[model samples]
Target chain A: MLTLFYILSAITLGTAFLTILSKNPIHSAIYLVLCFFSIAGHYLMFNAQFLFIVHIIVYSGAIMILMLFTIMLMNLNKADEKNKPILSRIAAVVAFCLVALVLLATFIKSQPVINEYKVSGQDFQSIKVLGQVLLNNYMVPFEFASVLLLVSMIGAVLLSKKEHINN
Target chain B: MDQAIIIEKGIFIVVIFAITMLFAMYETLAERKIAAWFQDRVGPNRAGKGGILQPLADGLKLFSKEEFFPNTENRFLFIAGPAISMTTALMTSAVIPWGDKLTLFGRDVILQATDINIGMLYVFGVLSVGVYGIMIGGWASNNKFSLMGAMRASSQMISYEVAMGLAIICLVMMTGTLSLGEIAAGQHGWRWNVLYQPVGFIIFLVCSFAETNRTPFDLAECEAELIGGYHTEYSSMKMGFYLFAEYASMFISSTILAVLYFGAYNYPGMDWVESVAGANIANIIGIFVLFAKICFFIFFYMWVRWTIPRFRYDQLMKLGWKMLIPLAIANIIVTGIIILLADQNL
Candidate 1:
């Protein structure tokens, strides 16, 4: 399990670096996808199969696709797509490095190491168990999530249609 | 599980995984041959006998082909598109029960790779992930047509998923269990649920075609408009993975359809086979029976593909949402009512 955890975590971080380092917009998008997938792998390693699938659905299935469609629609392939100049790029890189260094230091210090680990199997996984808890204990939030999705869907359609209406 | 059981399960997983890859490879050949027959032409007889070995020849061709990338934004996303699709397609097989239990050396050997009780749900979850492959591939292509294709895929998939989920909910309510093996067991000995839940079966069957991205529901790669669809920019082996994964999902999903609703490894008078041929021989026959059912579904998929025309986007959405969803909900309610009445009589 530790081996699995390390592999997934490395993939997550490595893909993130590649996501930034990759020159091509399509390549970056692909790396972003790789990052999302690695995160999903992490979810599975943590025994959250439902979360893993949901993450893939939300991020890989929908969000990344939305991004891809946006990129294609805008015809940003010939150039790097970023309008920011070289000066901004250098500053952004420096800031990113600083942020990463600090975050890494903090993560190492804050990492949780389980010694005598014990967790109830039913509590850890299973939709039936999750469903019971969700409806009873977290029903408000669960319902709210649907409302959030509805809001976003409406927003997207409205925004996409703005171009049509204006024309 | 003990060490020996663990070892056995490992071997079982390997075998099942290999079988899935092999079936998927062959399905590609079968699809081309089928399409050829429909067109009154011989397909790829040059590669091997009756074009049986054509898949390997095609695979080699893919490898030897030149690769090119259109200057595109987000090259990472471009590569990620097909990889996601391929992996997700293979993931669904983790829970499918391939055959009935085999008794060896006084030990009961289950035929599934992993009988994790939440098997059906797992398949649905993984199947949903295939949408990303199309969406991302299209987007990463950085072409107008590709983006349109991806957008079409996303909307179509999400809409159909509601009906698909409802169909599954109906099945779950009837079986009272989520385990695939248990589902197969329930449909044993000619007492298949298709007879009982014909409407449910039909809904599931239709949705499966869409879920697998077969023709009529294959809006993602409609060559008529989308210029090769999601994989327009991809070339060579990278492209082949996306195409191969679709067939892989098609074959595996068809198998799941057979095992779940149709009588998997079970036919009328299956008991008599065991009586005459003995347990070992009968179980082998059962495996063959399951294979025959899978072939029938594969043919059924092709038949439908050639028969129906591609749906307009709005029309597809309406069917999934208005017609299918409502019907599935009604089916669930009706099933509950019947089950309750039966319990009261008991």
Candidate 2:
């Protein structure tokens, strides 16, 4: 089980790094898809079947397809993209380090609490249990999340609509 | 798992793989024969009796054809395209309940590969992944037509998927389970889901056609404009994979339709049969009944392909988004209300 976890972690981290490192935007998108798939694999390993399938459906399936379509339509498969200016590159590096440091510090602070693995022997991750938890316990937050998504969807439609001068 | 169970499952999976492949192979022949019949032609009777060996001949021809590769940007992705498509096409069968349990050697053997809790969503997820196959293949070919086909396919699939998911949400609400095996077993002896959720069934049927890229919804590969579409630059076995994947998905989706709406492995007199002939014989018959339903759906797919003309791209999009999505949402709302009313006993 630990070995399997290690392997999946390797795939997740490797593909995520490749998503940034790949030159062509299409390749990067594909790598990001692989990364998402590996994360789904992790969910499956944790026996969160609902989360695993939903993650694949929403991220690897839908978001990645839209990303790939945009990349393909923009004809950005070429590897001849101009390098970012030195100042911007420096800013990116500094931002990356700061984020990494913050994450590491957070993990360290929470290390004692994360040490013990607990199995409650209660049904939690199955579709029924998850639905109950979401709809019953986290009802307000869940509805709010849906509302947020709906607003964003409306925003996307509005953004894509063409503005007619005559109209 | 026990060693015996492991062997049993392995053998079962192998049998299912073989069956799916064989069914897909024959589906191609069936499509052609049906199309020929529809067009008032005899079709290919040259291979075996009634062109029984036609698919084999086609397979041989594909294998012997020259494997041509365009000077594409990425050779790896070009090959990976059909591979992904074919793999995802076959993956959905894992959760399908082919038949009820059969006792053999004093052990009960479930005819399904695996009855995962979220079987329906697994099918949806894998199907959504199927778009990557066409997109990658089309983009890798580096042809304008192929890229355009890929874009059409991806958008069409994604759009239809929303409606399909919504339609299924209605069914899931009615059934109150995500497992296909349970859902199928629930429809024992004429309690089919379609009887209750006919509107949902219709929306799912249309969306399935769109999802599988069948005619009336096959704008992606409309040869009138895009030539061969995503497989425009593909040749030989690679091209065969694309075609085979389509037939395979058609077969699987037909099975899904049967399993979900039409009673899968169930007949009106199934209880009588079980009582009379014992569980083994009854279940064996049930398997055949399931296949019969599946075959009807497959025939229905071909029939629609032949009878209906392909939709224009705009019309297809309008139907998927403007029409089907709203209809499916309404179906869900109505189904929820009915369920709530039933629970309230008012």
Candidate 3:
């Protein structure tokens, strides 16, 4: 089990790094897909079949298609990507450090929660249990998330809609 | 996993793979034979007395053909495209319950590769990923027509998937389960989901046509506009792979339709047969029944392909988004209300 987890972790991290390092945008997008698939593998490793399927469908299937479509349409040229200015590079590094520090602090603060965790032999990862939790305990948040998605969907439709004028 | 179970599954997978490949190969001959029948012409009759060996002949021809590669920007992706397509097409069969269990040497063996709890979702996920094969192949070819074909394929698939999913949601609501095995079991003895959810069935059927790039929805590869579509630059067995993948997906989708809506491995009087002939004989008959239903759907696919004309790109999109999506959504609402009322009455 540990070996499988390590292999999946290696694939996820390796593909993620390759996504950034790849010169071609299409190659990067493909690497990102591999990264998403590896994450789905991790979800499956946890025996969270529902989560794993949903992750694959949403990320590797839907989102990556859209991303690939955009990358394909852009007709990107590697020569066009000039090196970043020193000031912007420094700023990027600083922002990255700040984000890392915040993440580290959050992890440190949640150490007790992690320590308290136990493998209670309960069927929490099944679809039934997940659905009940989402609809009951996290009902409001879930509904809000749906609303946010709806708003974005409507916004996309409106943005793409054409207006006609008779002058 | 037990050693015996591992061996069982390994053997099962291999059998399933062979069946899928064989069915796909024959589906080509079937398509041609059916098309010729519709056209009132004689099909290939040279190979093995009535063209029974035509698929083998075709396969051999494809294998022996020159491996032509155009000067493309990405040779690797060009090669990977058809490979991905074939892999994803075959992957869906793993989750399908071909038949009920059979007893071999006093051990009960399930007829599916894996009866995952989310088998239906697994099929859908794999299907959605199928777009990458065409898109990569098209883009890597660096041809305008191929790229256009790929674009149409992606957009059409993405659009139709929404309605297909909504249509399936209605079935899921009625069945109250996502596993194909459970769903098949639920529809025992002619209590098919199609009887309850005809609207969803029609919507799903239309979407499957689109998803499989059949007939009216095959604008992605329409010869008039895009030449050979995404496989324009492909040759030899590589081109054959794309065609084979299409037929394989057609077969898989037919199996899914039978399993989901039609009574999968279930016929009226099956209980009587089980009681009379014993479980083993009845289940074996059940397998034949399922295959019979799948064959009917496959025939339906060919019939529609030869009969109807391909849709215009805009018409395809509008039909997907406007017609199918709203109808599917309404079907879901009505199904939900019915279930709620039934529960209330209970």
Candidate 4:
């Protein structure tokens, strides 16, 4: 399972890199989807079923679909190849690379690798345990999440809709 | 590292993969047949008995057809779109418990190909990735229709996802279990969670329909407007892949629905089957039972597809943001209150 996890993670990381590097938005989007699936696989490797399904539903299902809509609405598929100022693109790439390097180095140093151990416990990824914790221990945060959703909903509606026509 | 266990899991996965592919292909046939039936005529009965072999014939034709590559700019991205869609669609079944465990040759062979604790979350995570497939395919197609399709697919999926998550949260609250197998086990009879979480079930059902890119909710590939939608320019195997992946996802989504809402592999008299036929055989039979449930869902997908007209873009957005999300949130509140009252009584 550890080996499988490592393999999946490598594939995910490699795909994420390819997603960014791909000149075409569609190609990048597709690669990004693969990266998402690979991450979901890692979630499965850890036995987080509810999270896995939700990951697919929210990220792959909803967010990706929105991204697709944005891409189409903008008609940016093949237009990406239109030559831009080379210096700017090069500078942007360099900046991104520097950020990636710093982030990777810091992350590697901050988190020490631990020896692998046999997985043990009741495997409380079950909905029952999640419910108990969500309703009791994390009730405040849970309620807040709902409030956040409500705000976002209102924001989306307000942004999408025209001002009231009341005269 | 026993050879038998390796072979066991390997065979199970391969078989499931094959079944999924076949189901997807059949779903295409079913979609067309259902559409034709709705229109009062025979569908494709030329290929085989009642068109049983149509999907295979279609596959062969696709394999033999010319793979056209329009002189589009993002050729690589265009090529990658269908591949992503197909891969993610099939990848989701890894954690689903198809049936109970079977004891064979002094070993308990798990019916599921893989049983991880975060199975539900893993499925969710993979679903998010699924967006890339469509987005990439559309953007790469270098066509307005394709791009538009991809865009619609993304926004529609994302919006519904929030409501879907909220709906699932209610159930997640009620059952207090995230692992699908346990969810199924918790509802071991006709006393399915659907009865308890009616609002959640409806919301989840609607979201699932939207998530799967089915009709009425399918603003992404509305053929009347988009002219064949995202795969408009795709031909040969590339087109086949996109279509195949849709079916595969439909089947998987239906299974997820059954496992979550319906008593998955748990009929009313499931104990009798285990008692009479013994655990292993009964479980194998239970797998068949689960398949039947999934077929009905696939049928339902087709039935609704033909029966309803697609929603306009704004209507689709409104359904997701204004209607479903609020309803789901309300359901959560109701469930919370119920749980609170129950706790007080106890």
Query: In order, what lDDT does every prediction score?
Result: 0.81, 0.91, 0.92, 0.82
Tens-digit lDDT track of model 4 for B14-129: 99998898788888888889889999999999987899999899899999999999768778878888998999999989888888787888889887877666667667767777
Off by over 4 Å in 3: A79-121, A162-167
Task: After superposing candidate 1 on the true structure, give the runs of residues whose Cα lies further than 4 Å from its correct spot.
Answer: A1-124, A135-167, B1-7, B39-44, B73-76, B105-107
Q: Which ten residues in a row have the lowest lDDT in candidate 4 chain B?
A: B114-123
Q: What DockQ do you compute for every candidate structure?
A: 0.30, 0.89, 0.86, 0.48
- The stretch of ten residues in a row with the least summed lDDT in candidate 2 chain A is A111-120
Chain A TM-scores, candidates in order: 0.71, 0.77, 0.79, 0.71
Quote the lDDT for A5 in model 2.
Answer: 92
Badly placed stretches (over 4 Å) of model 2 are: A77-120, A162-167
lDDT by residue (tens digit), candidate 4, A147-166: 99999989987866755543
lDDT of 2 by residue, A1-167 (tens): 99999998999999899988977888999999999998999999879899999999999999889988888897863565777899999999999999999999998887452123235555667778678778987999999999999999998877667454336
What is candidate 3's lDDT per residue for A88-121, written digit by digit as tens?
A: 9999999999999999999888755212223555
10 residues in a row with least lDDT, candidate 1 chain A: A113-122
Question: Which residue pairs in candidate 3 have backbone atoms (N, alpha carbon, C) closer than 3 angstroms, thus clashing?
Answer: none
Worst 10-residue lDDT window, candidate 1 chain B: B121-130
What is the full ranking by DockQ, best candidate first?
2, 3, 4, 1
Model 2 / residue A25 / CA error / Å = 1.0
Error of 2 at A87 (Å): 5.3
* Candidate 3 per-residue C-alpha lDDT over B286-312 given as tens digits, one digit per residue, 9 for 90 to 100: 999999999999999999998889889
Sliding window of 10 residues with minimal summed lDDT for model 2 chain B? B167-176
